[model samples]
Target: MTQAEGGLRARKKRETRAALAEAALRLALEKGPDNVTVEEIAEAADVSVRTFFNYFPHKEHAILGRNPEHIERALDRMREAPAEESPLTTMRFIVHDVLRDLEGEGELSRRGELIMASPHLLYQLMLSSFEDERQLTEALAERMGEPATSVRPALIVSASGAACRVAMERHKADPDRPIRELVDEGFQLLAEGIDPGFRVVPTKGHP
Candidate 1:
């Protein structure tokens, strides 16, 4: 296809994906995920069910679409980042960049509200976060270009991942708050340090 045609096709695909996501979000918020069938979503999107499958591997995936890809894109964006940027800074770049995509369209806020409306969708978001974390850690490790077993890369990833998760959960709980401010707070908390025992706890009635 000519360059112009290729651009048009890309735009069409983006539109299709957006439409499907919007439909799924609306139905999820309106009826609940269990009640919203893939067929209904496809119909709402103005596409055949087959086209829906073509875009998303499963119904839940349609809701998680582009999230991981957004992280990968941010990772790619900093391929030539200056050496002066700390690992925390690089992670902040990725965090903000991924969020930028979401807020660029009211779609992020809408879909986020949808996820809150459905338990299944909330689980899907958690699963998506795990996958995205794995992909992101591995990408950062590879960028570090050191042994996978190295402590520095692992530590960087663990710290960043924990910080980011806290940031996300805070936003989910309060969409009205500034996402960037939350992320900064998360990273600051990391810098201040979490309690070593925070990851584990005693049984009830025990010290």
Candidate 2:
């Protein structure tokens, strides 16, 4: 096939995938996820069930609208980060940028609410979070010139994920506060090494 044909085909596939995901989320919000079916979502999106399955493995995935391509795009952005920046710093910037973009879209709260309302969806989201962490670990390893098997990369990625999760949870509690600000605060704590209740004793008579 010609390059133009391939490009057009890819764009059409993306449109179909997005339409299905949007339909799934809208239906779930309107009638609850437990009440929505793959057939219904496909019909709402004007696509066949077969096409929906091609984009999402199941109803939960469709409702969550988790796209693997998003991870690839994030990895690309991380790769473009300044060479002098530490991996954690690059990750912080990426997370902040991602949250800022989502804030603009105004769907984060609704998505969080939907996931929180569904136990099965929450479990699936946790599973996907682990996978994202693994992919991030590998990307950080490459960025830092370390072997993919290195423990440091995994530790960094896990810590970063934990920090971000905490930040998001706090944001959910008080959503009036800007999520990006909370994310920045979380990353700052991570940068500080998160010493557990450790306090330095002043040198005797030094002050």
Evaluated with lDDT, which candidate comes out highest? 2
Q: TM-score of the candidate numbered 2?
A: 0.84
Highest-TM-score candidate: 2
Alpha-carbon lDDT, every model: 0.73, 0.82
Residue ranges of candidate 2 with Cα displaced over 4 Å: 100-106, 196-207
For candidate 2, write residues 5-66 as lDDT tens digits.
99999999878877887888889999998999999999999988998889999999888877
Clash statistics: count for each candidate:
0, 0
Clashing pairs in 1: none
What is the Cα-based TM-score of model 1? Answer: 0.81
